[model samples]
Target: MDLIGALPRLAARRPPVLLVTMPGATRERLAVEAELTGRDWPSAPGPAAAAGLVVAGRAGGAQWLGDLWNGMPRPRAYVAVAHAGDAPHALDLLGRLLSSGREGDAPRAVSAGAPRGAPGQGGGDGPDHHPGAPGSGARETPGDEDGRSGRGGQEGRNGRGQARGQGRGQGQGRKQGRALGLGQGRGQEQGQEQEQGERGQEQERGQEQERGQERGQGQERGQGQGHGGHRGGVAGLPMAGRADDRDGLRLDRLHLPLGPALADWPAGLVLDVALQGDVLQSAEAHPWEAAPAGRYPFWGEPWLRAAGGEAVTRGAAERRRCASHLDSVGRFLAVSGWPRPAARARRLRDRLLQGAAAGELAPEVLRLTRGVARSRTLRWLTRGLGELPAGRARELGVTGPALAADGDVHARLRVWLGEIERSVHGMDDPRALTGVDGPRGRLDGPRPPSRLLLAALLPLLPGAEFACARLILASFDPDPDEFVGAGHG
Candidate 1:
């Protein structure tokens, strides 16, 4: 029936894509996301599930990109869209490549090894199987330096020892026969006794080796239980260290970095965190790159241009501000585990960016915002999270909605909703722009507002759980493009 051959073609109709966004590539990312949504093609959450890799914008010398591509299952496709306008063509090419079913059309993997089975197959030890991932089984014990099993090596050593023992016994018997001139029977008896002793010693040594191997296996099992039911380290990586948690109890602290390639994550924003039992002990924010000097940050462009005496219209600035909030709202919703509202927010944002008039977007925007604002469940989930008093924010040189919210995650969300409503109504204003404040913060600050946002994270993340930490970052939603060429660290 050739069902196996036909599977690739069937799956190619709408292959899942793993989209990677590089630093300073928000415009291209948005374009790619919008295109994917239009086609009803699903987005793959990770490389393990992806049938293709779609990178929006340049690779920016990110070495991890190649690793991610190699980790995906074979018969995969890849495309890089350097410009927002190129997203459609790039994705179209990806689809064609996936459907072609020709090995030569597939993107070359970084590793020369044959393609591995899908994740969870092959004893759940495939390249994409992360030991820490939920439901992953125990990790296979690492082999010795020469790639030989410990048991096999131990047996080989034991065999050689037995051979040496026999040779020595034979030599002793012959020497006794020649030197002492003992009877042949006596010499043979002595030789047999010597050989038996040697064999007994070898048996004892083999037993000790087996016991040692058992102890090692037991220790590994204990370590796996202490961690996530998998070995602590993989690929020669070191194991996590122990540290006192918030409750004063010592626990394993894993240093994990949430990345530059995660889905719904900010472009180029990397949060290096030390986590103990799902709670963050500390977090450091590193902006990978910044917009080049004289290049405007995408979300803050209107305000920055207006501040530069470009004579931008107030209506245009308001529209940009509205779109910015929508974008942030979408990311927050997605991270909060609400996909439908997140998709809706993104659609609204795209419509605004496409120059849709206020009259056409106001109704939908109002409905989305109202729904999000009135959800008790949402409020309950976010209330008392990422709290930052107005006084504290001002002390940190923070501005914009973060300062205005003056409370928790819920407060920040409310501020965004309020500003979105206000801006949507003002999108038609004809007056020239007068304020230098951008969607994020004041453009005239000594440093970029996003830098302040990044700095604020160091303090806010330490006491929060890992999930709450992600929400806090999403609420802040610092645009990395603002740091470009700004010598950010």
Candidate 2:
């Protein structure tokens, strides 16, 4: 029936793709997302389900990239799009690779039982082993490390192996008990101490059963110690240390580094946090490594050029400001568990960037901003979260919408809506932009406003739940591009 040949063709029809964005590559990311949306291809939720990976932007020396690539299942394809203009071609290449059943020069798939620390698997003696780390000996499941849906076959095999070992141990115990019974029978025939001999044999059989159980348990433990050894941790990762949580209760605190690659998160930003059961105990923001010197930050380009004595019109700056807010709104909505509005927001952002006139975009923009504003459900979800009062924000050198909102997550959202509405109306303004303020904040500061935004996160995130923490970060929506080629704060 030629079924083997047909398999690739069938799988290629709509292969789920994982989209990765590098820092300073928002334009590339937007282009790739637009292409994928047009094709109606589904996005892979995690490495386990990805059939192809499309990295949008240059492949910098990020260690997580290698780890994620190695964790995906076999028969996969990969392509990197360094420029926005190259997204379509990169995707076409991905499709061809998937349909041709060729993996090209990617590393060989590591066996489920292979030790993670082995050569070329990307594992080492360092504590860099996370769930999806290359050769970390950990299974890459969807969502969390403890999840179990992705690797069912390997788990089943291990389960069956344990069962067989237990069965063999019991069988040996039975044989040993039978031999003791025969000896006891011979002793009974020799003397009148038959009762005592039978009691001794019964005790021996009980002891033998205990030994059999011990052997079975030992075998199970050995099987469980895949590559990590028995250090009392999952998947060879170190055990989480215990700490006193906010409520004065001791809990296990797991150290997790978020971002630099997470979806809807700021590119090139990494937040290292110690969490005690989803409650962040502490957080530290790692300074983003600057990109090459000549590349300008995308959203703040107009203002930056204006500051450099270039003639930039107010209308162009306003258009960029609106688009920037739309982008942030899209990310915030997506992270808030509202994907439909998020997609609409991105569509509007793309239209604005493509030079749509104010008359054409005003109605759609108003519709989206109003829809998000009037959503009581979204308001309820975000209200009273990530509170940064105006005084506190001023104290931290914060400005812009964060200072304007001066309240909580909902307040920041309101500020964005207001700014977006105002900017939309000013898209036709022809006056020269005298001010050096960009979408995020003033561009003439000693440090970028985003740096102050990043600083604010240190105080706001610790008391919030994990999901709330993400929402708070989205509310701030610090653009990593602003930090490119700039000194650390």
Candidate 3:
């Protein structure tokens, strides 16, 4: 925008006018040259070279004022005079801009009065303005300024020559722009059509799916109707008479007898046998459908339990065998000696003596007792005999061989006996015995055998349970037996 040198030339040379075309604020466009020239230089182009210049003011067309300078006789000398508020800069550049300005009279019609406010009638533009007046080949109207109507409007209306020049210079560019715009419009329309086609296809697929679903439902209903029709026909048929009802399992005769040897039937066939007092007589084979219940063991001995029957022999079953209960008990008793009964007997004897001396037991019991402890897992049953009765606390303490060796009852009582020993020796508080309802009144109790199963049989033996628990530990460590219990007795 700075034009310190161009201002003096504009005024000295008196270029008729200047033309400018650019998009900017109005103030900047109008004051651009004047803003740049701080003061006028002494020498510049005179009125002989510089004259009024013209520029397009409107936008949105390919024929902008920039088009005039696009093809120039020189590049660095391209500044035209400034317009509006900027007109002073062009007038100021009159002296220095002389060598660069194009000197020519303005066209006769359009330049008629630019030197003054009277359009084409002003004298200040001098002789150059009248030289190009008749360049318009058309006739002039008398009342029109510059022999035209509106200045820019007249150019637009009657622009055969000017438009031809502007259009020829920008011909290829304008055509390309129009072609691009057309292509974009076509692309937009095609996109919309493609979207609509996809929607239509989706709607058609949805309708087809609905039809298929309807067809399937109709087929199912038809099948149900056909089944009902068949069932109705079956209902019309008559049923059997009452005589056949009572005979639930009718057997077919397997073989006809001709007073000869008996022929064996096939193994799998079920039969109803009629015998004469444990003798084989006649057999009528029956189908599985008509077979009587609980006779399945006749099929084979392998399935005796499943058939709800037991094997029986007609003979050789009632014979004698050497057997007695005493012998079995004697054998079991034979293994009981040494540390088992002798050691057991002395301990019980000692307890009796202590109980009598302490007045906890009847004195009569110490004189006539034997000790035999039975093994049991329940703390109650195995110790019952040695325990005092519920209310009869004075019963003989060690009367029978009650806590016999290695029986289920003996194992359970060992716990209570230990408690009693602890109480006797000050190992346990005597007052604690009242809390458990123990030895004096709590002994001699009876409970069912399932207590043994729950405590001993159902739960694993301690050693066995330890080994079973180790199975889980093995998943974590390679050497589990070192920490987990080994399966030892």
Clashing pairs for model 1 are 290-483, 290-484, 291-484
lDDT of each: 0.67, 0.67, 0.24
**What's the CA error at residue 22 for candidate 1, in Å?**
1.0
Estimate candidate 2's RMSD in Å.
Answer: 12.0
Model 2: per-residue Cα lDDT at residue 375: 98
Kindly list the per-residue Cα lDDT of model 1 for residues 1-489, writing each as its tens digit. 988778888888899888877667778788988999899899876666678777665553343454455445668876665567767766776777777776424242111132221222221124333222333231122211211111100001111111111112122222321221223334445445555676658766555555444545644553454345122333322247888988889888866555656666677666656778667888776646534355577887777777767888999999999999999999899878888998999999999989999999999999999999999998998889989999999999999999999999889999999999999999999899989788888878778888898887568888777678778888998887877733222
What does candidate 1 score in Cα RMSD to the true structure? 15.9
Model 1 Cα shift for residue 74 (angstroms): 1.4
Per-residue alpha-carbon lDDT of candidate 3 for residues 1-489, written as tens digits (9 for 90 to 100) = 648555544444432333332221122222432322223222111111213323211121112222222211221122222124433433333223343433422222122124532223221133322211333211111111111111111011111111122222122222321221233334445445555676658766555555444544544443344233221101111111111112353332111111000001111122222222222233333221111122211111112222224443211110000001111111122212122332233333334322323334322222212122233322232232222221321222211112222233233233223333332333222221111121211112342111111222211222222211111111111111111111110
lDDT, candidate 1, at 202? 73
TM-score per candidate, chains pooled:
0.74, 0.74, 0.15
Residue 141's lDDT in candidate 2: 22
Q: Candidate 2: list runs displaced more than 4 Å.
A: 103-232, 236-238, 485-489
For candidate 2, write residues 9-110 as lDDT tens digits: 678788888776766777788888888877878776555567876766555444455545655666787666556876666677667667777653342221
Candidate 3 Cα outliers beyond 4 Å, as residue runs: 1-18, 28-66, 72-77, 80-87, 99-162, 167-489
